[model samples]
Target: MIARFDYIAAVILFSIGLYALVVKPNLIKKLIGLNIIETSVYLFLIASGDVRLGIYTNQWAASNVIDNPQRAVQGLEPMINPIPSALVLTAIVVSVCVTAIALSVVVKLYQHYGTLDAREIASLKG
Candidate 1:
């Protein structure tokens, strides 16, 4: 039951984010909703990469060596795939950049219209 909590939390967060995005009229709230969705995705990805019972292999130098074929087979403990974790790290950086750009755009929009509501801004633009 405890193991399924991460997925449940992800679902809940995703739904909340979706709801906020669909129901909110404020541009800033919509941006926050997008951030929430991104966070939920990151949580799901990190959960997928989790290995509670796996052995930690810290072979940085050995990874470069092509001669040691036996090293790969020597581990009896299941090794967690490192690619997802690495990808998640990259995603985090990208998410931050996206959020910053989004916030900057929102700032510009607010400056131009003097309002944060999406409906109001649209009406003002027309």
Candidate 2:
């Protein structure tokens, strides 16, 4: 359970974000929730990609294991997985772009409707 603490925290964060996204009536609050959700996903991906190397895969090594040639030769030495990190980086860029676009739209909406409340905007729509 302790070993999987990060996963647990990520789940909790995701739940909080989901609740905020669903229940908030303010556009800005919803955007903040979306950002929180994205952050939880990032945390999950980073935690999942973590590889602990030592006597046991779950146990942390007391010393640096990257220099162990024998383990490397046997394909047992723990190495960093770049795929998740790369994906997270790409996702962050995409998230930023999406958030920027959404914020711009919100600004336009506020200018047109003179309000940022979703319910008000919906009711005012023709």
TM-score to true structure, per model: 0.76, 0.85
**Highest-lDDT candidate:** 2
lDDT of 1 by residue, 11-125 (tens): 8899999988889999889988988998898888888876644123565422532355465457633445678788888998998999899999999988888899888887775
Clashing pairs in 1: none
Q: Which ten residues in a row have the lowest lDDT in candidate 2?
A: 55-64
lDDT of all predictions: 0.79, 0.87
User: What is the overall TM-score of model 1 with all chains considered together?
Assistant: 0.76
TM-score of 2: 0.85
Model 1: lDDT equals 0.79
lDDT of 2 by residue, 9-92 (tens): 999999999988999999999999999999999999988888755636444576455678677567666666778899999999
